[model samples]
Target: MPAIPPRFSVTPEEIDRVVATFYASVREHPGLGPVFAAHVKDWPAHEVKIAAFWRNAILYERGYDGNPMAVHQEAGNVRPGMFDPWLGLFDSVLRHELAPETAAQWSALAHRIGRGLRYGLVEAATLPGGIPKLV
Candidate 1:
């Protein structure tokens, strides 16, 4: 594989554009739209939060500062194993729109997100069964 490019920083405008384009596809994605629809009350607010998240994650400009997992968890949308589709949709968006290097970086981040969500889901699922105490 070719060397990944230097992290290409993103602007709010680019974040907005990318997020809008991404969600357009996401809204059509199987296993994604309904999941989000079941949780999000206002589309515009959700859009803004995601845009900010992208900006902060893809850029070091501190554009997005929301606690994404907390928001989703609070919304009762933290279905066990749901991270697969979440990461999948992001991967699809990166593949459809980003440069190869950019896609690679985004993929790396998405993997982390999926892993975190996976563990969180497992923990949440085990809660009713007496989660083991961490040493």
Candidate 2:
């Protein structure tokens, strides 16, 4: 049996470059920087982990092993509203770091994932009986 190939025409090195560049922007983003800063003390380690996650997601690699939804829920500070700015920043970085076609592909994937994460955060924060809290 042959192994599955990567979904997109991007290399591991490209993934690393994009991840590094995106997170550097993230660290300086007014809306996102503080949120990430509160949790990620080691930027380099976080970038490596996130790059592994993208590799797993896009390249069919088995290097990442973590639940993003669970981690966000556990953080208790990740808001649903943050997804927009986060995705916007991510799209910009993708556009700047990769070829236009590759950037579009990655952006589409990221937006889909972001929507799931945003929905999860919203559901996690809602009150019982399908009601959202007023707070």
- Tens-digit lDDT string for candidate 1 (11-67): 567567667777777778777788777777787777888877766666654556677
Global lDDT scores for all candidate models: 0.69, 0.92
Give one digit per residue, the lDDT tens place, for model 2 in 23-123.
98998998899999999999999999999999999998999999999999899788999999999999998989999999999999999999999999888
Give the residue spans of candidate 1 off by over 4 A. Answer: 1-11, 128-135
lDDT, residue 48, candidate 2: 93
Tell me each candidate's TM-score.
0.76, 0.95
Evaluate model 1: give its lDDT. Answer: 0.69
Q: Which stretches of candidate 2 lie over 4 Å from their true place?
A: 128-130
Cα lDDT for residue 68, candidate 1: 60
